[model samples]
Target: MISGRICIGLCFIALAMQVSSAMAEVFTYPALRSSQASDPEQSLLTSTQPMAVIYGSADIGAFVPVIEAFQQDNPFIGVEYHQLQTLEMYDITQSQRANGEPAADLIISSSMDLQMKLANDGYATSYQSSETDALPHWARWRNEAFAVTQEPAVIAYNREFFRENELEPPRTREDFIRLLVNHDELLSEKVTTYDIERSGVGFLFLARDERFFPGIWDFVRILGQAKVKLYSNTSPMLEKIASGQVVLGYNLLGSYAETFTQRNPNLGVILPDDFIVVYSRIAIIPRGARNPDLGGRFLDFMLSIKGQSVLQNEGNFNPVRADVPPSTFSSLIFDRYGERVRSFPVGPGLLVYLDQAKRQRFLRRWQDALLNRR
Candidate 1:
């Protein structure tokens, strides 16, 4: 009887081990427990209950108000948000699905190219509603990827420094280039911008800039001449500007800059007069989503006028919907700057630079110009 009992216990252990392995494969704890997961301020997954999982590049702080508002209307649906880098979000979504495992129900990212690639590759599930239908022609593509926020790439500078130094901030690309050329001594290492190779959104901005401005490479070489500092994220550059460490940040996210400017009155933002490049954060429902219906519902909610208000007022994010007036900062900027707002269109054109060989070539050219290697 003792031997029989011991055998039964051994069998139970084996079964438990198998179940643990299966759970690990299913949940992918490493992805969930990313750096953002540990920060209570960054994650909304406090409850142990089942919830719709969202993988996005936006910070959790900005999402809190939107999520809370969503929950008010959707009491039955809980939300689990994981903030990951733009590239990581794309890679994980692709990898998890390729491995035949469930990934996040929703994927939100600022990398338009990557998001477009996913949809083109059939990774996104079709979703549509009245809200989606109302989106502008340039904002939604094929009922797969939806642009949620309209954010521009703007220039941020230290207002105090500009005032004290009696220097006028650059309002156009020509003015910006001239500033760097003329004030090399004062601006040396004082200007910071994104390191495109490391930042997906940065790459997108650079790509758009190149397409919009023919002499963009010459400007890049000028940045190299000025000994510009580089960073992978916008907040750090904004922080540096706010603290007087850096005088200016180029091609910074307008949404984040607006938020930072509110807190730091000394910071200034400029929507370039020559032209402004606008980007929209695209959201997609992954093909392997555990709950596509819930994802669709959330997606619709995000596109709704109600959700857009929460984003503009509470989240400090620009709304994508045009009907949700009074217009957000994007519209205000466009109005003030004239009709130079070059908003990226949600279509196949975004996928051009995403090709492996083409991407490498573009990066190589970027490195050469930034390094002053001709």
Candidate 2:
């Protein structure tokens, strides 16, 4: 009788062990803890050979240090970066997704409208980061994408040129046009700006101007009449300004302006009184990403205070986090230059504006206005 009871007990123990093993096979420890299996940080570290690919711009020199720092904390994951022009990045991402291949893990770019379009098209996955609560509403998408860097579009000028010409920086839109038209001798040979036809961000800036500024076409006409030199990208324009080859650049980004000014005190930035448009570079993880868990963790890291500090120190950009202390930006001299920094609201359906038809129309109109089509 004792032997039979012991045999039955052993059989029951064996069945329990088998069930536990099956459960372990189906659910990870972190997944079991959460209602949904989305928290993948611990799993990602333990998983075999994690990898990610990023599509972004090489012009953002500030991202280099920050990415290097992230890599230090995540040694198990290998990240590959593909540097491409803004439009090229967009096209490649869309094409890859359409081909049914694994989409890129992350997309970061200065073209806010394009990023918004991706989010709207259900191409990106929605993720709420722990640090998102501290950000302004305008910086946070339906948790689909997050604005990681905030840069105000302002006027960049060469101090040496201003002093030589005995000219004060322009304060309003009217003053800006007057300066360009009346002081041609000082600016005619040295002015540099965006080539709207060739640049996604430049065209986006023009679209914003069209929406906000009345008679923006006339403004472009004035710039054309000034005989301004047009460049294909912002970095080249900034380089020319830094070298004093260009006396001034309108609608230059604040982050680039600060970086150049740090290296050359002769470079100056002015925020216009009529209203400054602040642009934020955003990041999103594609819905079909092979490593969504790692991508989500990265998004959280970017929105965190530590991440924003890294951006400010390395990239010279303002933090999207509202709680960032005033002392953090005290080193910045926007107020001293009579510049006002303001954030613009993201309009409804703004992302769909990136359709091919709209883009072509905008480029054509911009060319007509800036290149003297008449």
Candidate 3:
């Protein structure tokens, strides 16, 4: 006879397999092709000049203009930008480093934990320049990993739905829970949040939420009781909010949400009035980088006012530089809500939950709360 524990373990394995299959179906990494290749997915800007490869989790379309602007100043060098999922970037960099081959000149990822792990484990090399030196103390770690953006975890909702119903959108976590409870019938299955287990960045946000907010578990429980939808990525949730399939999405990346809301006037973003948890996409240079000089140069460029301007104006990413003007969507938010913004710092503390046993235990507790399971 199969024991209950064994059955549960098998069920989890099956669920993981299904999630992997689903992710594979929905996400495909574009293959690297020659500079002359016609596929826009292949390169941010095709060039035959000396190349500097950048591995990042950012969408190519959003980052292309930054690279194009970078090349305008450094015309002798070309960029080959390869987009990967956050975890994929960490794994590939580690594997390549172990094999004595570096994968890219620079790496950019939303998973601050994984990026910190790489630097902590000696997988990244240190570099310092005027731009790096001028960074806020919290944004750079030992000159090895530097935050390049100031995006926050926020709530996104359907603006038209709220306006038409004469209901005020949630401005804080408590309000969100109250709204869900008070309008249970209207909100049932009409809310969504990250599936933490499947999304590295999502898990990071949840871990931080648990630490920062004492009522986080209770909030998760309310979300579960509301039958909140779960997704591994933010885009689908934003899409659902835009289409009114889901009335609201919780803990979404503010940068992406702001960008999406630009083209989708009906979509709205709200930074919690109680507090805002800001996350940054960290940049690092691999220890085994084939072109370390170019990597350093690019890293410096990314931290420069010009590079940050492109990130803010073109990439729709919030700038990490304090000198950057509050002209972009997120910067304007920062200006208004700076006091509430809790920027996740670059340090060893982020590694706490990454412990295999700790991660599993956290997920188990989260499942119990959010899944209503024993």
Enumerate residue pairs that collide in model 3. none
Off by over 4 Å in 3: 1-48, 328-331
Better of 1 and 2 by TM-score: 1
- Please give, for residues 259-330, the per-residue lDDT of candidate 2 as tens digits: 777777888887667777777787889878877887776666677787777777777777778665433343
After superposing candidate 1 on the true structure, give the runs of residues whose Cα lies further than 4 Å from its correct spot. 1-48
lDDT of each: 0.80, 0.67, 0.80
Over 1-374, each residue of candidate 3 has an lDDT whose tens digit, in order, gives: 11111111111111221134111111111222323457776665664546787888886657766776676778667676666777767777776766766558999988999899999999889899999998999999999999998788889999888998889999888898899889888888999999998788899888888877999898988888888899988888999999999989999988778888778999999888988888889999989897988888888888999999888887578888878875646655687788877778998887886899999999988888987722
Worst 10 residues of 2 by lDDT: 23-32
> In model 1, what lDDT does residue 217 have?
92
User: Per-residue alpha-carbon lDDT of model 1 for 260-297, expressed as tens digits?
Assistant: 88789989998888888888899999998988887988
Candidate with better TM-score, 2 vs 3: 3
TM-score of every model versus the real structure = 0.85, 0.79, 0.85
